[model samples]
Target chain A: MKKHILTGTLTALLTLGGLSVPALAGPEDVVVENAWSRASIGMNRPGAAYMTISNTGDEPVTLIGLATPLAMMPEIHETKTNAEGVSSMSPAGEIVIAPGESIALEPGGLHAMLMRLQEPMTEGDTFPLTLLFDDGGEVTVEVPILSIAARGPED
Target chain B: MQRRAILGYGAAGAGAVALMLFVGWWQVDGPGGPEPIGQRPVALTAMDFRLTDHEGNVVGPETLIGRPTMAFFGFTYCPDVCPTTLSDISGWLDDLGDEADEMNVVFITVDPERDTVETMAEYVGYFHPAIRGWTGPEEQIARVADGFRATYVRVPTESGDYTMNHTASVFLFAASGRFVTMIDYHEPREFAVPKIRRALEEETEGAT
Candidate 1:
């Protein structure tokens, strides 16, 4: 009778352990946070998007593409200055997020340009965006629309 | 009787000639000469160049003609100096009331990399919507700066970032797009306003 009790206890413990495996798996390996865009001005105005990308996986991830409902095309850009005192902006091939590291996209630096808006983006509106990673994974986030003067100091 | 009349006429003519000579001598010695101001008037003329505006519009020296223009060079990310100068100019314009309508204020962004036409349009609107901002292809911008004798250099920082050191003078252009004078960043209002006023008056006088 004692040997039969030991076998039943082992079987119960194994079943309980199997049920908790999903909990240990947690969520996705790559996370995107604080995704936002500078608000658009008028119907003809263009807007820019900014965000922070954090990678939790052991392998490095590359951001190969981006998309937004507001823009016809989304592109990653960097500002470059030449010796002749002119400023120009060009496309960045890819943004790499190393394992256990975060990359920040901010003003006056690397940022995503939301080109050719379908409609005007007004203040207090939120736009949906999706970012595509090189590993065939994607994340969706909402970008808050703000006034053009939002980031500037009060007059 | 005829001889006496002739002698009186001769005496009157001699007295009139002598009076004219005395008046001319006094006028030469009086306040008609130049003032005793220590320095001679320096001609503040500058050369012209072609550049592009925030709308990618081609603008040349001719754009400033027909109005008194105030031109300043600064960057969009400048934390203090650039904004303050622009704000002050806006306030000064407010004080000028109807006079401001005839003036044109321009802000040229020194940082071309970050100040695209779209960025400049947004940045310039923050100060005052009336103030026009100009940025161009790198070569064009450099040519304009060099023509104005403005100096700008980039210094690398420890973080691999860099800062630009540039001349901070605000240039004044006449109605004909000729350089009239310059107001240093630290020029007092007592000095600057009067000079600007004089330039305006001169422009008006020329027009009339």
Candidate 2:
């Protein structure tokens, strides 16, 4: 509720401020917005990336995997909390985005899990992450590293 | 003779009724009456386990005594919830100002195989200075988790590696080592800080 309003307002304000969003690469029909990640606590620990991927084309697209130099292994993982409040993570296999549909990989849910980071992801830093699709399409987006406690990109 | 036997049975039945009423009243209103609803007295110190802190110091339940303690369970490999919760705790400690010194904020790792003492030291250093990370033998971790009423499981992922599924709530304890309440995952700062304050308040009340 409030988060949606805040995000919408932030997007509107950013548009009004004349700040352009990150440029979409490869297939322009697939839009990636709010690509963001948190600073890692240590170089040895893992980090995460989140964003909303919208497929505006006439056909469905499957997100196959992710690639980044920041970490040794970057894969799509889904964090699930059961009824007992025990949270777990598992590899999220290729996610299919239907036409005119959007898939959001957010905190406490589906996200790009970066394992064994080469260096600590510090605040105020940016990195390039390539998202691969099953159709031989790829999209590279610039992910801004925010504070470790940041809940969203705008935060 | 039959009437006398009947009278004796009736008298015994009356005595039994009186005894039940007395026992029921004693449980409800006696000197050692039942605790108020939702107030279950839990002694956290009763859990006996030993583990080394990030600083390589062997610590047990005794270390938690004499301070309001906050403990959470997770793995260092965890990317989202663990770091987010730790950062949130750091913010709470910042809001506490000088009062934070009197608290014990601990992060216990369920994945002892990966989270060594050195790993924990570097990990906790990123958060509040007051935070301490604890890791030990897998059996000891299990013992501590059992005592804290927490749970965790090792889940194998596709990359020939594994992840942990663990309890996500932060447990609070009073200075006397009595279990307080829990702060759920992603709980807002407004509610989380007050819970910590209440644990501190318990110490004040106990002092006098």
Task: Give the TM-score (0 to 1) of chain B in model 1.
Answer: 0.72
Fnat of the models, one by one?
0.02, 0.57
lDDT score of residue B133 within candidate 1: 88
Q: Say which candidate scores most in DockQ.
A: 2
For model 1, the superposed segments whose C-alpha errors exceed 4 Å read A1-155, B1-48
Stretches > 4 Å off in candidate 2: A1-22, A40-44, A55-61, A97-102, A116-124, A134-136, A147-151, B1-42
Which consecutive 10 residues in model 2 chain B have the weakest lDDT in total?
B34-43
- List DockQ for all candidates: 0.02, 0.30
- Tell me the whole-model lDDT of each prediction, alpha carbons only: 0.63, 0.84
TM-score of chain A of 1: 0.73
What lDDT tens digits, residue by residue, belong to model 1 across residues A54-77? 788898888887788788767776
